[model samples]
Target: MSRTRFKVILYLDETEFSRAAAIYSAILMMNMPNMHLTIVRLKESNQSLLEIDEKCQNIWPTTSDVPQNALDVFLARSKDVQQQVLYSNPNIPDAVTALLAYVNKWAIDLIVMGAGEFSKIKEVIFGSLAYSLQNRSPIPVLLVKELSQDFLEGCNLTPTLTIVPKNQHGN
Candidate 1:
């Protein structure tokens, strides 16, 4: 769809890595003012939604511990921002079902997450969270490696895939 009104869900969970996703989302938001961003903060069973909400409400107005924290606080205050706790469960491969449901309900264009590198063999055997989303998500799933300035120019990207199909002649 158009980047002007792109709907993005920054998948933030318990991982310290989620900060990267938040920063990436913020950059994209800044670049495209019309872009609608929803921060999905995934909390574990130890935290109640009430507790999380209370803490966020407190922090959004007062938190300036870090640049990322301040950015998140500002984002939380923005009218476009939608903070969803989703469940008592944590953000894992198991959470994909709930996330997919949300994606369908809101028509999310993309799911941006911070993914830690894993061995191919490990992923093939046990599977990883990122791969799980990649395989399952109907919409595009972005696993942020590093922030790029390309997003600053509205990300006019046309990705090229290496895979090619054989012709009827089987060249």
Candidate 2:
């Protein structure tokens, strides 16, 4: 059987340090021969989007607070990593919708996003995007824990990994 070609959408946010770390971890653990990565940033305005992308693209993987040891490990292990940037307006629902639209347009096989820190009150009131994506995305959504190196490695061993069809469901 042919190995699956993977398009990994790395969801970027204002908290890019954490996002980059999660992406780094995913890239290292999955280590797919055919994979593409795009860094997505959601903002409150178009201008903010541009600003955020510019700042993020420049600061990522460099100024990012990812540990030096982890950075070394990622660079050494994930040679096939590719990067792209996307921008979207703030509205959480709108941003997610836009992200899903982009994912479908690119025929992305997987989405890798970091689970941001959330207060219990906020989570209870607003809900978690990661949780929502796991249940709602058409394709598999890998919600990563901050600086967790073993998560994707665990995913790699799971049997019968399902690839949801494009038209199967709407996120």
Model 2 per-residue lDDT tens digits across residues 61-99: 543544454444445434444444555566565566666
For model 2, the superposed segments whose C-alpha errors exceed 4 Å read 1-4, 14-30, 46-61, 65-80, 117-121, 147-171
Cα TM-score per model: 0.63, 0.58
Q: Tell me, by TM-score, which candidate is best.
A: 1
- Compose the digit string of candidate 1's lDDT tens values, residues 12-126: 6555456556666665665555667666655556343222343452223212221354275345437656556565455456466667777888799999887877899988877
Which segments of candidate 1 are over 4 A away from where they belong?
1-4, 44-77, 88-93, 147-171
User: lDDT at 171 for candidate 2?
Assistant: 36
